[model samples]
Target chain A: MLIAKVIGTTISTIKDPTLTGRKLLILRQADIDGVPFGKPYVAVDTLDAGVGDLVLTAHGSSGRQTEITKNRPVDAVIMAVIDHLEISNRVTYRKE
Target chain B: MLIAKVIGTTISTIKDPTLTGRKLLILRQADIDGVPFGKPYVAVDTLDAGVGDLVLTAHGSSGRQTEITKNRPVDAVIMAVIDHLEISNRVTYRKE
Candidate 1:
C-alpha cells in the first residue's frame, strides 16, 4: 500500500455502472516523509476519509475486495486512514 | 494499469496463506517505448506471461480481482499480455 494524501474529490456522472455511489478522491502519492509527489490519481474512498487525511491506498484488483467495490471495475481504493506513520524508528507523521 | 516487462521470478517460502501456489514474477515498470525505470517489484502472474514479455500490470486492490488472486494479499498482478501498443498513431511495440 502507498501512503497518500486526499487532495480533492472527483465527480464523474458517466462511468461504469458498478462505480455508481462510490466516492472518488484525488490522491497525491506521498514519500515516507509525507511529502506529496508525482501526478495525482483518483481512487475510491472506502473509509470516509476526507480531504487532507493521510491514507493507505490499495490499487488495481485489490481495490475491489471491499464490500462496496466487489466485482466492480474500480482501480484504486482508499483502504485505511493513517493515524500515524513511523519509518526507520522515527515518527514521520501523526494524525491530529 | 501500467505497462511493464517481466524480468525475473521471486521465491518466497514464507508468505500469506492466500498467496500459496501463486506464481510471483519480478516486473520492471516501463515507459511508453518499453524502457524500464525505477526499482523492480514482484507481481502475481495470472496470464502465464514469460520473462521479457510486455504486460499490463494492475496494482493494489485491483490486483486481487482475478480468480486466482481473489481474497489474496497480493499488491500487484499481471492481468494481460500486450499484443501491441500504439500511441499518437505510432506503433510502440508489437509482440513477436
Candidate 2:
C-alpha cells in the first residue's frame, strides 16, 4: 500500500468494458508527512476520495480485491482515505 | 507492462514462505531505447534474466498471473525478456 494524494479525476469513455461506470482518479505518492511527489498515476477510486484528499492506495492484484474493482484490468485502487498520519509517536498530518 | 532493465539480484534469507527458492531481481524502468531511469524496484525473475538485460515486467495482479508468482505476496514479475524495441519505422533498441 502507498500513502498518496488524490490530485484529480479522469474521464475515459473508450476503455475496457469492465471499467464502464468506474471512477478513476489521478494520484501521486505522498511521504509520511502527506506531501505528494513523483510522477502521477491513475487508480480506481473505491472510497470516493476527492481531489486534494490524502488516501492509501493498494497496487497490483490487491487493487482488485475491492467489490468495485474486481476482475478489472486496472492495477491501482484507492482503498482508504487517510484521516491523519503518525510517525515515531508524532502526528505529521491530519485531514483538514 | 513496463519496459525495464534488470540491474541486479537479491539474496534474502527471511521472507514470505511462498517466496522460498524464488529468484528476485532489481530493475529500473527503461525508455524506448532501453536506457533505464527512475527508482529501482524488485521483481520475481522466472526467465533467468541477467543484469543489464532489457525486459518487460507485469505489475499488480498481472504479476501474479505467472505460474511462479501465483498466490504470492509479490507485486511485480519479469515476464518477458525483450529482444528489441521498435517505435514507428525505426528500431530503437536491439539485444546485443
Candidate 3:
C-alpha cells in the first residue's frame, strides 16, 4: 500500500453495483516521507478516511479484496490509516 | 494507460522465468500535456521504445498482456509509443 492524503470526495449516486454504499474519495498519493506524488486519483474509501487524513492505499486486483469492491470497477482503494511505520529499525511515522 | 518517456535501463541478472530475453526499460511517466509526473518508476519495454520516446503504458493485469510478462511478477509495462494524441477538438501531439 502507498501513503495518500484525502483531498475531496466524488458524488456517485449511480455506480457499479458492487460499489454501492461504499464511500469514494479523491486522494493525492504520497511518497513514504509523506510528500505528495502525481496527479489526484479516485480511490474507494474503506477505512473511513476523511480530508487531511493520511491513508494507506492498495492497487490492482488486491484493491478489490474488500467485499464492496470485489469484481467491481474499482482500481485503487484505501485500506488503513497508518498510526506508525518502521523500516530497518527506524521509526518513520507516528500519528499525531 | 499512461504516457511515459524511456530514460534508462536496469540490468537484472535473474528475474521471473517468463521475463526471459525481453528488454526492460525504465520509463518516466508524464501527464496528458507531456508534463512530468511523480518519482521515476520502471516499466518493461515491449515496442522497442528507446530513450526520449514518449510511450503508452498499460497497468494492472493488462500490463501482463505479453508472453514475456504473462504469469510473471510484473506490473507497469510499455505497450506502445504515442506518435500522436487527439482529445476533444484539438490535436495534442505529433511525432517530431
Chain B TM-score of every predicted model = 0.94, 0.98, 0.83
Q: For residues B1-96, could you state the per-residue lDDT of candidate 1 as single tens digits?
A: 999987765443433445567777666789877777865555789989988888999876677788997786457889999988899999998888
Q: DockQ winner among the candidates? A: 1
TM-score of each: 0.54, 0.54, 0.49
Tens-digit lDDT string for candidate 3 (A20-60): 57676656777656656776555778777777777888887
Give the better candidate number (2 or 3) by DockQ. Answer: 2
> Residue-wise lDDT of candidate 3 within B1-96, one digit each (tens)?
456667888888788776777788887766544555667888777667788877655568656655456667777676555555443334455556
Q: Which stretches of candidate 3 lie over 4 Å from their true place?
A: A1-96
Interface RMSD of 2: 10.2
The Cα local distance difference test for each model comes to: 0.74, 0.77, 0.66
Order of models, best TM-score first: 1, 2, 3
DockQ of each: 0.10, 0.08, 0.05
**Consecutive 10-residue window with the lowest summed lDDT within model 1 chain B:** B10-19
Which sections of candidate 1 miss by over 4 Å?
B1-96
Better of 1 and 3 by TM-score: 1
Chain A vs native chain A, TM-score per candidate: 0.94, 0.97, 0.81
